[model samples]
Target: MAGLKKKMTIPFARVPVAINEQKYVQEVLESGWLTTASKAAALEKKFARVVQAKYACAVNSGTAALHLGLEALGVKPGDRVFVPSMTFTASAEIIRYLQADPVFLDTEYGTNLITPGILEEAIALHPDVRFLIVVHYGGQAAPMVSDENQAGILEICNKYGIKVLEDAAHAFPARLGERMVGSLGDVTCFSFYANKPLTTGEGGMLTTRNKEIYDRVKKMRLHGIDHDVWDRFTENKPSWEYDVVEAGYKYNMPDVNAAIGLAQLEMAAEFRAERQRAAMFYYEHLGQLQEFMDLPVTRVPFSDHAWHLFPVVLKEKAPLGRNEFIKKMAMAGIGTSVHYKPLHRMTYYKNRYHLDAKSFPRAEKTWQGNVSLPIFPYMTPEELNYICKTIEKLLKY
Candidate 1:
């Protein structure tokens, strides 16, 4: 066994800055026009090309992207949307933003992802549901299209006329078979939050093939202004003469943040590869402890996954509970976190919808033991070894 080194702190996540991040930001700084200009436009073009989408709109956050995408998809007041019980608050909260209700569904046990069967069952109960927000949980793409033997979420939703909005917040640069996530759903949203697979400090993107949806989101992202700042400023027309098509939110990504995004986008493939390396290390080191804990499960190859998180669910027979295990790991200088407590268990959702623990059996079970360990790009062998050894010591009774 490797000796546990004292005071060697490993954060749950660390953004790996790309070589061009500084250079691009410097160029943006020198350009004088910094707010939502050429850099942001460049990012949108490059991002769309990379994801194989017809159009891409860069926004300030993933939540903003969701809000805009839902609005564009005609999600109106009193509508019901299907969301997974095991995701960040942003997934369900966006539904509420449109004055719509979320019908939270239980996820698959190990993946914490809402499967095609779950979606079909929910649709059976709520036949009026026309919208669905499919979260690509922890960087694994949910089964969107049907296969030879079974119908997928997209196939099932299409039958019921459900508009699918993919929350690809943790799944940038991920693929489902040959198609990347951004191009798979009706509208796809990606987060560039500090700790995500790609980071622009605080930024996001929305991509879609429908020209109407694309135009709606593009106009609405910046206070419903028909003309973007770049267009107004660059064109020969008057910069001040823009029309407000509708009352919209201010969710445009700035040139500075977009500058960062450009650099990060360039290194996205490299970053994903490094993350996969770390995941492989964890599997090799901790595979023996499967009896005591459950590691993340994915249907696709590990290389296809974004590898944003490597969570483990401690079994009933483990030496310690989830909280205790986290504390011990912290004491050993390793940082850990819980991906979520599930929206069904949250006080607001529970009180509003009268949710019951029995309603979400898989999510409930997974939540009890969920602990997301440190996984990031460029993690050293020593760091990986320390994390694995610590888990072994804690779990091996």
Candidate 2:
């Protein structure tokens, strides 16, 4: 302890500012059309093209995108939505918003995603379930393209008339062959939160191949307006009059946010590569600690990971518990986080649905020891080395 140097603090996550972010923001400021105008429409088109979707609707938040996706699928009260327990609250909360029930499923230990077996069981248990919110957990995709009799997960869902709504919040540029996550699902939602692969401070996009679903999401995203204000203002024959098609929420992304997203989109590929590099650094260094922890898996067949968050699971034989390990890391100026607590363990969901921790064995087991290390596009090589060394030292001690 006598010769120990002070350790500089490392943050768990950081947003990478695109080269043109400031320029785009400044342009939006000068244009004077801030609320879901030309910028939003342009972003939508570009984003849709990037994800290989027919349409994309920009919204205020990822939660809003999920909510509208449910609306687009016509989820009604008492309808049951099959969801994995190992996800963020938004994935389940949106089901409640529609007055629907969420039938939670267990996660697969290896992938930390819902598998075909889980799907089959859930379907048998709740035959009337109409929707499935498959989250691309940690940017590693769910079994969208599986080798099952019904084809893949998407096809399986189709067999049951269950609409597959992808919660692609962590997966922006993730792909399975030529088809992207957004294009595979009936509707897909993406987040542009500060810590996401792409950032707009706070924004999201809802994409779909169905024209009807696309049109409905577009209208519902903006107070059910028959047409967006951008159309009227930019047209040669401009008129202020508009009709409200239905009661809808006020969930439109402003131009300021869209401008940032546009700039971020331009550098999406670069951002993904940088994140992947950082993840590889973690994998290479941390694999040595396999006796104590399960390092994040990089190679999953038929898929390309977005490398959103590098999560490692501490084995049962670990010397210290997850929280204690985190405390030690914190003291050493190394930041760490848990990807999620199983949603069923949350008080509200447990009380509402009568869930027991014993039921979701895989989710609970994974949640107990999971830790997400600092991973971002901007992480320097020195930072990566420091984190790796710190973890190795802690494990040895």
Q: Write the per-residue lDDT of candidate 2 for residues 165-216, one digit (tens) a residue.
A: 9999999889876688789877999999888988889999999999999989
Sum up the clashes in candidate 2: 0
lDDT of each: 0.92, 0.86
lDDT of 1: 0.92
Off by over 4 Å in 2: 1-6, 148-150, 298-303
Can you write out model 1's per-residue Cα lDDT over 1-397, one digit (the tens) per residue? 2354555789999899898988999999999977899999999999999989999999999999999999999999999999998999999999999999999999999998889888878888999999999999999999887898789999898888999999999998899998988999879999999999999999999999999999999999988889887898889798789899898889999999999999999999999999999999998999999999999998999888999999889999887899998888988999999988999999999999999989899998999899998999999999999889888988874
RMSD of 1: 1.4
